[model samples]
Target: MGEAYKLDCDICAYTENIFVGFGLLYMRLESIASFVQDAALKRRIEEFIGNPSTRYDAYDALYVCPVCQAIRNELFIEMESDSSQYKISYACPRCASVMQQEHIENNVPVHLSCPACEKGKLKATFYMDWD
Candidate 1:
């Protein structure tokens, strides 16, 4: 099952919600491939589905833009081809910077600098179960 979390700023009103983990449909290779927005990435995932030798992992997760400190919720997909070469990068929607994956597991708090109010800290709080 998946999980939902809400991030609230300790000193400001900044708030955002993120959903992470796998749903029932995510278990299906085709469905997971379809969920990827990048055409090239989707094709790579499809190739992995066709040949199971190439390992792959896909999930809904939080991503942070190092340059702008922006937060984004997106489908994180990774797949290695037979040649053991696979590369995927997600650009920050706000600043066009590369985004790094962040995990919110077991309801552990993910402390972050608030994108909206930089002075405040964003605290991740488990809200509910999803999927």
Candidate 2:
């Protein structure tokens, strides 16, 4: 049998590397801020600094599917009719199914089939993220 080695905690390095990387990132951010000269960007930064509550809304309001629970971003499309109102449509990322907003809101899958089981059990959900 081979000789066993004793565990040594003193030799182990446990320092956080992420914090060092973040410090370097902050340096890079300062350099980038010096290069940016757009007036709109400056105004936006000032607004964010002055009134933090006036932040951009991250979520795109959408209807989700009932079966598969897929999240879809709602987009407005003008209808062929004379009405000025636009119709909403939801698209599934996995199945590439384009469904009308009314049907998706009602929890119905209009044009997508599940690739795994070949069943029409697709669903949708809405999601949002901050910039």
Evaluate residue 26 in candidate 1 and report its C-alpha lDDT on the 0 to 100 scale. 78
Put down candidate 1 lDDT per residue, 44-107, tens digits, no spaces: 7777777767776767888988877899888866777676656567899888988998888765
Give the number of colliding residue pairs in candidate 2: 9
lDDT of each: 0.80, 0.32
- The reply for model 1, stretches above 4 Å from the true place, is none
Number of the top candidate by TM-score? 1
Model 2 RMSD in Å is 19.4
Native-vs-model 1 lDDT? 0.80
TM accuracy, model 2 = 0.23
10 residues in a row with least lDDT, candidate 2: 14-23
User: On residues 1-131, what C-alpha lDDT tens digit does candidate 2 reach at each position?
Assistant: 11111111222321110000012212322332344365544343333333333322111233444455454443222222232222335556665566433233223343434334444433433222122
Residue 73 CA displacement from its true place in model 1, Å: 0.7
Query: What shift in Å separates residue 79 of candidate 1 from its native position after superposition?
Result: 1.3
